[model samples]
Target: MENEIAIHNEIDLQSKIYTIRGMKVMLDFDLAEIYGYSVKAFNQQVKNNIEKFDEDFRFQLSSYEVLELSRSKILTSIQVKGVKGGRAYLPYAFTEQGIYMLMTVLKGDLATRQSKILIRLFKGMKDFIIEREHLISYDEVAKLAIQTSQNTKDIAVIDQKVSALATIIEDFTSPEMKKDFLFLNGRSVEADIAYQEIYSQAKETIFVIDNYIGLKTLVLLKSVPENVKITIFSDNLKKGLHQKEFDDFLKEYPNVTVSLKRTNGIFHDRYIQLFGISEQFTALIVSNSVQLEILLNL
Candidate 1:
């Protein structure tokens, strides 16, 4: 039974390995599944021992990187979910060394045996690639075949980018104009445009109210003029954005300020209030739904 389980695990590990950023990596979701743990639990362990995992050992995937992997045929077999449910944060990827280091952190007999099997599987894959490289060097036809395979992969990447570009163009060229009330279904191109427009229009004061705000929200405020005074009102100062990360964001935009005030169970909605140079106030009430509704005072 132990032998059978090891064989199954080897096959499963092989399937989960992916090439991202010129390195082979296994996503946190798949790694958690192999270790017999929930995604949240697995990530929590990593967070607890963050000092063990360096930039080379593990790295979080960006939104664009995640989108690219989603569109790839090679990665289609992997279950990559969007920022829904309990997966609001981005996924992390672990390299071969990182996987080995993870075993040291994970406890129990099952983790020990599984770690040995995974290390063997990783070594086998490396040997196989090395052998293939040697074979390709001796045979011209083999080299050509490898080159053609890479070209096909490159074409697929290009096709995916073109499709994304077409979608953005369609959103921009659409005849529908901005309305006082807008319903945004997730993070669409139109929603991004609206966010930018709101930030750009803030001439004097820009006030934001949200329970949780991350690096993505900070990026939207980058377009605010230097003279504009930006203020953030939140229950927690470092809920989504860490202290160090928030400090860096402040360095980039020195005009911004943050204030924390606990509602004691009253505030629950997200809002953005902009004050123009002429003291004209405009407010945007954002609904906390999968399809976010933006009530704008134009």
Candidate 2:
């Protein structure tokens, strides 16, 4: 009877797993309930053992993310109550590692049993995803090769799928090169790092497309090799002081050749395309507010 109950609990737990911030995670409230603790107490214990959980293991959902999750129905009950009501706190989300680390801090027999079950479930889910990817990769690559020999339209579709699969494979194999989607509200550290990475890899040219270009955006390009060619396609050529700032930057970096063009057509989005030797290129599609960045290798 006890074994059956545990099996049932594990099955229920699987349904609670959610993909947030491109990671599989569980909300603090749900985990607390499964571990037989009140939400307040469970979160308190996590706070006390904060060192056990790093940014990758646990993260508090942002307001934008909270709204997004609620709209998607992944977080069915998410809402903001009055500030005085103590229900206004943003929820903490725990990844697989965070869930496992909880076992070290949480006490009681129920916690122990649930932790063991959860660890197994998390591992099983990871294994399943990896196995499925491997199976799909073999089938997809064969189809893609055959499609390439056929026509341009079919080749384009195959190329897109192959690029996506490559990203997935890189994320699984080369964890260090795994792409990160970063929020770009302010001076984003991740954005700076990404810029540095792209600049470091560039051997020939850097192409940029943004409707509006400002000094802040140009700051990210300063570290590019002095010999590399830079091209900017923008809707607005007159950015007042920012244009002057870019002029000064060009004067300072004499070896860098930058050409700014007023885009002939309406282009609403931003992209940073880096071209390297032998036709190798990588691209970053950035949001207008600099609020989002998606990195892709081609």
Candidate 3:
């Protein structure tokens, strides 16, 4: 009977875990209940030990995210703690590391038991994934080649599904030149496309920090979302970019707004900061500056 009860608890815990920002996480409400505390009191304990929970560990949900999660049935519709009419403060989501950190602050039998179960659950998942990745290899590639030669009916759909699954596995395990994009000589067009793709991910703002900027940078800014604001910081060395260039850029892409500010020799290297609606990503700079053909895959 104890074993059956344990199985039921595991199922219940599994339902509370959800994937957000490509990481498995649990919402504050669910975690609070698991740890035997009210959501209000739970958050208070976190606040008391706020230093432990960094951005990777825990992050608050944006209003848009709340609606999105609710629509997908990942989260239930709920109002802010004290607000009456509209949603004010969205709940915080804790990553695996953050959930582990919560136990240190929350005491008692419930916290201890839940922490042990969570450790076991995460360990099992890691082992399962690590073991399965070995299977998406020689057999799958041979099958793909065979299917292509035979002119299969669902070739397009099948290929897409296979590629998507491979990409997910690669994102976690393979160091396919991880996080570093090495552009070669005569690949200016490809470099520009890569930069545009990274810029397009920003929902709110994109801050480009380069000590030596030029007219060429304005061309890259054109791909950013019309609603997102852009700020470029460059030193005096950026004399290559004339006021006329920016004027021409704005005239052509009036919807894309970009602001330029001089750093006056403060920054040493180039960096791109992509700020999402609810989260902020910082310091994604190619090593040894950008003109040297180094950029982020992120």
Candidate 4:
């Protein structure tokens, strides 16, 4: 029976786990399978009791994460629902604690038996990591990522190969973006990814020019590394971003220093500049006149 349980752990349990947002998690589809429910039904149940799941317990993957996970066989499987013909919503992922909360909400003999097995498995995994914590450090993980992907483009492969530790490094740190040119039109998510990736590279300061800047702009700037000074010039703060909204954002992300100023009709365009180490710089031109025809010039 011990041998049988070990086999079950390796196949039914560990194989379903994936590293996401610095935590090991199971996708909604996989959890639905184990709990004997349709993906739609399972998600609906969780939504009904959403108060039980916090950001750490459950969270939706970002658009870029969806793109990255699509490379995985489990995600690419045709059986996965809510991901076809321009997906209505991204899938939700559940952490170990989330699974614990979920078992309380779900009923049935299968759920009861499976929850016991899962708790045992979760305990084992936690104990193993605790015992080996001294063997792992943030610096060591960073060095591993640097060594494995000297060519940063292969960084996605790290997500596939060394998912657990790779996810920790990727989450705590940003990846190198090698795009020399990115054109954006009718693509909100891709544009957001580009904005975040470029901003994450800034070591000291950022310059921005957008006539219609708003709270959403600050949301994008949330990706800028801590302590990076940001200066923005906008023609329509009254109509777009208000002082209150700006203050709230600053309070929430106190580490991100930002200043907003009016363009005063000096410029009629949108662009961004990133200043990094040794005074190196990069530029992005996003035209509001064309409804965001963006160009990031590296």
Give candidate 3 misplaced runs (Cα > 4 Å).
1-8, 77-87, 135-298
The candidate that wins on lDDT is: 3
Give me candidate 1's TM-score against the actual structure: 0.42
lDDT of 3 by residue, 54-159 (tens): 9999999877766677777555644544447643468899999998898798887667788888888878888988998877777689998988877775787799
For residues 162-225, write the lDDT of model 1, one tens digit per residue.
Answer: 9987875455445563332244432343565677766777777788877677776787788777
TM-score of 3: 0.42
Query: What is the descending lDDT order?
Result: 3, 4, 1, 2
Give lDDT per model, in order. Answer: 0.73, 0.72, 0.74, 0.73
lDDT of 4: 0.73
Candidate 2 colliding pairs: none
Supply the global lDDT for candidate 1. 0.73
Worst window of 10 by summed lDDT in candidate 4: 1-10
Inter-residue clash pairs, candidate 1: none
> On a 0 to 1 TM-score scale, where does candidate 2 land against the true structure?
0.42
In candidate 1 the C-alpha lDDT for residue 121 amounts to 95
Candidate 4: clashing pairs of residues: none
| True-structure lDDT of candidate 2 | 0.72
RMSD of 1: 30.0
RMSD each, Å:
30.0, 28.2, 27.7, 29.1
